[model samples]
Target chain A: ELGPMIVTAAIGQDTSLEDGDILVVTQKVISKAEGRIVDLRTVTPSERGLKLSIETERDPRLVELILRESKSLIKIDSERGIIIAETHHGFICANAGIDQSNVAGEHMVSLLPEDPDGSARRIREEVAQILGVRVAVIISDTFGRAWREGQVNFAIGVSGIDPILDYRGSLDKQGSVLKTTSIAIADELVAAGEMVMGKAEGIPVALIRGYRYQPSAGGVAYLLRDPASDLFR
Target chain B: ELGPMIVTAAIGQDTSLEDGDILVVTQKVISKAEGRIVDLRTVTPSERGLKLSIETERDPRLVELILRESKSLIKIDSERGIIIAETHHGFICANAGIDQSNVAGEHMVSLLPEDPDGSARRIREEVAQILGVRVAVIISDTFGRAWREGQVNFAIGVSGIDPILDYRGSLDKQGSVLKTTSIAIADELVAAGEMVMGKAEGIPVALIRGYRYQPSAGGVAYLLRDPASDLFR
Candidate 1:
């Protein structure tokens, strides 16, 4: 009850969440709640998808979902067979953060929660009403980076918080013009929480303490950078 | 001697080295060491640069570097221009992690260390000799993401450690296949260290404790993803 179970219970209980409380819910729980399970057997791979499977070396159904979710195809590596893509969320993560792990049955996959931010907002509003206090909710998933090693958890969906803190026009110690822009505070928090919520552990959720954050109108969408403005794009 | 010293003697003393440690040196220190200062009086803007400046509303020298480093020109706003390019290190980031901040005088700009991985390796070797222990080094920089808010610190150069940990054939608790490919532990560590080394605090180097990492033959250059194999190129 001290880990994921406690987190699950806390979500259901009526209580007030405070300013610094962090509700760490696992992607699996969110996926389960939203009924995002995709049965691989039910998915009939199209001829085009079969050809893509031969080309990309990925499960046909998963490849189909990835193709459907992608805004634009970036590349297809034959060796790894990874179809790197820009998901609907404008994130250029591998496989669009799709997964075939931790499903209840054979040949089952889980899509990322549809409208994750909306789901987070709904949960935050409902929990606030029950507990009579404000709180921040973050839905996390594992992601790979372009030129770095190892996967770390990141916040795919967030609510009741400003994920990025803009510090433009501030002053540095040397009386210099401070143009250091946004700080991805929410993503850092998610990564920090992942340290305790290890991949091998069944602890899918954790409650973060001690860190303080302020509410803003921007919410999580502010964390999504427009590709047009991205120099790395 | 532990909390915030203000003199040159207080920085990089013989006694300040340790085993299995990663030293994160700021660009300011590297610029000061290498004497790569651009005095405004000596800077003669090219006519083309000046005309581009007028159109873009930015410093001509800065824009010149941006243009030279870019592989493909993306967009140009009034004060900001975006370009996608592979850095000299083969990693892709904005403006190649160049900056106009924290310079000693007006119109002075600092380039990234001539060879960041070399600098890191040199520091690691020096510190290891001094302390008689194995150590790792990572030269970090703040960079903007393609589709994310806020800049998180990432490893521009690394040595003595593996940047990515591959977990392709691992198993989950439920006897499921874990295709969790790679994890960017080093970059994540850098981001976590930024929490302690605030941009304004003048504390560029932080000593991270408790976490343990393995040694590998592959150095920091291995962290750079090949654009051909990269999914997000």
Candidate 2:
């Protein structure tokens, strides 16, 4: 598992882990450690996957995997060769969070971890046993936004941390009530950690210290908005 | 201006500024420092402002300021009391980034800086002259996401840094080329910096050191998606 590996690497790098520190791990490493790899050559496409493959110009086998991982299809931009899908985990991303990059071979792709929050908990437990320090664990993945051109890393799973720093009843500097001012701090923490864990560099973990984050057992599911309330979805 | 104030606070905290360091400042403090404030009693609502105020259940004067700052309106969720608009700077946020909180008085509202990029450049110059060190400046504001439930601090102004870390031609761990994997490092940096700059606590500045960034004169315009190409606008 990547949990003990992360502890070894932290000691190797001379990083002294402390209580309340955050450990942000990329979803790729967790997926790889869990054997969520698929060999495209060994897979067969379904009828719907073949039709979608023709439209998205993607491999039929890869499309089949995407179909299996997705709960529903959100958009099919055939002109752009992109398929926006909602994963079974309620994540809206391109190709159901399945990607061909950063894997073992050209014909292999990695699927997201089946239980991300559970993965976070297991890793947190492993690190606590080895490192002798309690730290928050966040599993993050990169995703595209609605009106933004570039993508930012967001939390898919969280453990030992509250997802949001709510300020609904907090008063501002002027003594005025802040009605809707909760900060999605878990998402921000992952985005910050992504800077150190750059793509194509194989750096899967980032440590954030000195930021006092609220501790909780809240998972990343708190960040997802319901489609009935989300206007864009 | 907030430039000298930030340097003073850093000195008080015994932090030394270094080259390649990033300074993320909140927009609320910059607006308050720049005198970009208005009294609600001084504003006279127009015909369109009154019409929108009735539907949105907002003050007509506040609606007038939102309309003046917005270049175009995208969505008006009357039931939610939200005015999703494309600001003159092309940022699609609620109420054109105007807010009544964080000001000095109950009837005062703060408007976003007229030129955020210029504000960043000015602050960058101010810090260089005082501290005798080069630092990248990013002005951040809390913005609500379209699909997410809470808000995150995003860079609205940037100077002395390239907004994106382009990894298009870079090869991944599997030796496969990453076609579309540019990281929005500026936005990610601000998201990290926001951890120190908590909302309603009056901590409007954050210092991030030891991060190596490619220097450029690129502005925050690089982050905005063109409406023509955006799928969900």
Best by TM-score: 2
Candidate 2, clashing residue pairs?
Answer: none
Per-residue accuracy of model 1 over B1-233 as CA lDDT, tens digit each = 11123112324464454566655666566555667555656656777658766787767777666555445543355556443446666656665556666676666776677677776677666665554666776777777665676877777767787777565677676777676656676776777666566666566775655556667756666666665555555
Each candidate's interface RMSD: 2.6, 1.1
Report the CA-based lDDT of candidate 1 relative to the real structure.
Answer: 0.67
Worst 10 residues of 2 chain B by lDDT: B1-10
Q: Total clashing residue pairs per candidate? A: 13, 0
Error of 1 at B56 (Å): 5.4
Looking at model 2, residue A66 earns an lDDT score of 92
Chain A vs. true chain A, TM-score per candidate?
A: 0.88, 0.97
lDDT of model 1 at position B212: 66
Cα shift from native, residue A67, model 2 (Å): 1.7
